[model samples]
Target chain A: MPIHEKSLIRPENIIRHESMNLQGVDVSGDWSTFIGSRTITDYNEDMQDEIAALPGGEYIHRCWQCGSCTNTCTVNAIEARFNPRYWIYLIRIGLEEELLRDKDILWQCVSCNKCTYTCPRDVVPEGVMKATAHWLELKGHTPDSPSTIFDREFSNQIFATGKVEEGRVLRRFFASTGQALRQPWLESMVIGLVSRLPVKMLLRLGLSAVLRPKTRKWSKSRAAITDYLQQQGRAERRALHLSAGEGTHV
Target chain B: MTHKEPTGDYNGFGPGWKATGLTPAEARRATDWVEAKIDRRALLVNKDRVEDIRERMWELEKDGEIVVHRIGDQHEPVVARTLYGWEKKIPTNSLWHHKSCGQCGNIPGYPSSILWLMNKFGIRYLDETDQTSCTAWNYHGSGIGNVVSLAAIFLRNFHQAYVSAQAQGLPVGTYYPLVHCGTSFGNYKEMRIYLMHSAELREQVRKILGKLGRLVDGKLLIPEEIVHYSEWLHVMRHRIREHQVVDCGNLRATIHPACHVYKMVPEDVIYDDTVMDGNRVAVSTGLMQTLGAQVIDYSTWYDCCGFGFRHIIGEREFTRSFAIDRKIKVAVDEARSDVMIGHDTGCITTLDKNQWIGRAVDKVYELPVMADCQFAALACGAHPYKLAQLHWHASPFETLLEKLGIDWQQAKAEFESYLKDVADGRFETLYDPKRAITSGPGFVRQQGDQAA
Candidate 1:
């Protein structure tokens, strides 16, 4: 947590004392040339193998690192580090280190899928970005992000009840985010007031978030679903390695 | 054999009633009439769809359905008791009304309805200046405007709202929480969350916003609660339900929640699909249920009402195709609901007003269209249904009301009184179109002239 003056000197660190033209030109000349030159060698080939294993993995090999995906990205316009162009370039070259550096950038995407929709050859750049980001988190190279939170708690909700319980998801989300215990008084007050309201009244106030009753038939299905996902993940990892081997020979 | 004679409130009692010797025009009027009479049947037949889905969504409801944490079902008890009644803390002093131009071009009174409701609740709000349209429609449609531009607009409006609220001694974002065009609210939330997700987007938006003014210390300018006017009405349904003091009697209304509001955040939509529970959420369906109307679930329940940004401006047919498949055909042939009640102005206009265009092109759907508020207002005895602005669709769903014995004369009186109270500065506009018009590149060119 200690601040180091030298930390400001990194290649990606472009100090902006004032606003600069964002039309691909830097009036401050602070645009990092190094962002383009960063080596693709830091990446492990296994990362590409892993990404080619997702639902929409066919589009992975289709990208040739054209900046069109990045240039068209609405997220990239604001968060430069969250560049699809750079992420795709890393995946293309297997630069695992650089990919991991900006893994948090993936969460910033609204999943509007605009990039995928506009892609020339229908390459799903968004999915590829997500696949690589997920891989980084699985390897412990990335920190917790919103998508991870949603995926974790949502999965837990479904995993436990075989269906999502809204009240549980929210409660877990709040507690996991450290907002639950920290705001104990607020929580208590909410509980007290909500408890006093009529059930019908609560539903009308958009409190359906907390009022969903449980599905009675889901208890037995949870074990089967969990087993299926685990088995699927192992099978996918094997298939990815085989595909990567084929790519190397080609 | 036909079971209860199709409830004669809608124009065409039920299926195949079109063959009943009524002329095509007469049949259209009959369909309208039949739609008016279904509310009486709801108390006996309607159930919340969420409860049904919750009961059946076995896989989706269980915790530990995945390999992550095996937190057992600890949240079910909390989720079962839906909360509706909240102490009325209406802020009428100063409200920073953010606007939407798309709603303005289509249905003008959506904002007016919000204002009317605000006055009814005696909540003080500010309809002030120096605030602009979130410009969300133009930006999202063009796919050119980035988070910076969006956040700048959000900050400017929130900043003005914050300052005004503080001037009145209220918390910054508390009193003036955003009440926007349906899509605008969804877009704002999406953009804000996305920006916050990346420190980079947050910093960039902050830099741009800083030029306008500081976000204020110790007070975040983000809206504390983003309220949709329909949701507000849904919350106050208990008080307003009794005022149905007007009798829709048996009007059959199919509630349409805007896709952007629910689809943009599916996790937030609490209503069910399999079950018919309409009173479980602050959504269109819930409000319709509260008004004592019958809500039918036709197939294609989740399809977009098809006012896709490009379709509305460039390709009219494409837009109609979405609307036809999603609303018109389903409302008539499948659900057999008489009228489609909409919560968003855009959806209302597309479903209600645009039907005539679809009809002229031989893509006709004979359903009366009105907003949930307009419908609620009608049920409350307010009429002429001022919110019945069908941009390209025909009007006079009067036949539907007539079938239910609702006097249009009463509706006209209620609507006129509502507008009168609004013009008297007694209400605050929740979804203002003129205000939305002020968001884009200065002037709205109305499809032909160059914008200034």
Candidate 2:
């Protein structure tokens, strides 16, 4: 696994001073890029097993230290902190505290599958990233990411109505996220679209908002899907030893 | 001798279509058996159980019972360049248009260009109302969706397409689904493999489908192969030139292959360089090359469009930063591309909307972003504003359209005239962004739009 020249150390982890005398030795300046010592005693030995129980985390044991996932990761290319291989390693070694340090940014995985595509060992690091994210929320290491909130909102709409209206989803996501619907960029986008969109087309889009498009006689299908979803939620929670319908705060 | 004269002729096809392998009932029984012995939790955790299920899936696929597609040995670029010569997977004439949520909402022209091109080519297609958003957006962005629920929705949508084709007197296998969104294209393909691989999942999905009355003749209607619409365009590049209304000989296109389409399904993402004069890119770039456009490659060509769907609507900073820093800057500095063409709606939206914000930071990368179909439509002589919907895009497209010989001034005037007739809500959208700027970065509120 050829790790790139880019070091995995975060700025916060770097311990430095303008000038320092470490035990009477001048161990400061450019040569003294000392990393802070990490104290880790809180280890969840079952962390890997718990994540493995979740959908995407099953292939964790297969990773043979291949850094291919991070090398090819789309998100990793931009935000170097979002490394799949490093996170997978942390999960495997049961470094729960260390893993938690990166939890907030973990859910940013775009599901690109480059990790899965590049993994020679079939570790499917993409799935592991997803499972780890799900794992964090279930074990109460982190609160639900905005990604999850958006997912829940969008899924609920689909379960209720057979399909989603884009306008409805966008507006509902903004509202639920407690953000202003009048985002400057978003407004500029809508304004430009409204200016040119044929009146008939605009009306059609507006009308869908009023009478949301749905599959005819879809109640049975919706009921079936919703029922399965609830069962899954409970089972996943049960795997992590949490009560159904409960988060850490709750 | 008389007994030999009467030969048996029971060709298995049509209304009583029994391809092979386990029937729906038998598959259900096998599922019940698996659940009784080992629950799905074990399957998710235990590699032995996972392997056990994959064996059964292989059996079904081998016997031609449950037709599923594997990327085989090829990546998307290879498949795109090679498959058109023989692979029956990429359907040209008849297709089922699976609508995209983002494209239909934000870039209306995406779907319009696709439909417009299909009609121009006399390609018979079905755009049934029953086909829904792949729901992958919800799944990936929020993690609200589980495998079972997503599978059920996938089956429900594709069943609608299948039934629609049946009612139209077309053969069962005539119209393969041409997915509009990269997310749906990738998600459905994954779901197909999942369902085939696990009998437990198959059984669960079967019960759900049965409860919903979506089972096609009491059997799961799995297509032999799933393909993205871009593949269709790439396969039909030869025919597209025959119907080309405008010559785009001088234009240069740099493609932004949607990650969801290729990166997720790397092997299945068509890969054929020879098809485009040795240029290795997705269908968009290949299609452009066929229309006499020079398709260029640049660094960060494989980058995500920064939609991070949830991030775009919720965490704006990440989307903005990634677009300018990783995607657009490379496209401009390295490729020096005339236009940045993308296939997926999320990609197009991210690229099209964020370029202006990039300029605010004094970024030099401001290529006009558009969906591949919109680009194709423009090359085929479609109007920039009316057909291609360039007016909706934030990127500067007047120069690009002019280079292609489109009357940008007349189109802008038409757009302006329509802008004058808007009563309230639409007109109200234009004012606040400037107001936000004047108010500075912190809690800028408009007259009615209060900052939350």
Give the Cα lDDT of each candidate. Answer: 0.58, 0.72
For candidate 2 chain B, the 10 contiguous residues with the lowest summed lDDT are B430-439
lDDT digits (tens) for residues B302-419 of candidate 2: 6787778776655554566577667777777877778988888888898877766543335556588888788888878776776677778887888888888888898878767766
lDDT of 1 by residue, B189-289 (tens): 57655643455765676676666554454222444334455555655666678776655547676767688887764433444322264343446676676
CAPRI tier of model 2: incorrect
User: What shift in Å separates residue A19 of candidate 2 from its native position after superposition?
Assistant: 37
Task: Name the lDDT of candidate 2.
Answer: 0.72
- Per candidate, the number of residue pairs that clash is 82, 13
For each candidate, the DockQ is 0.01, 0.01
Per-model TM-score of chain B: 0.66, 0.74
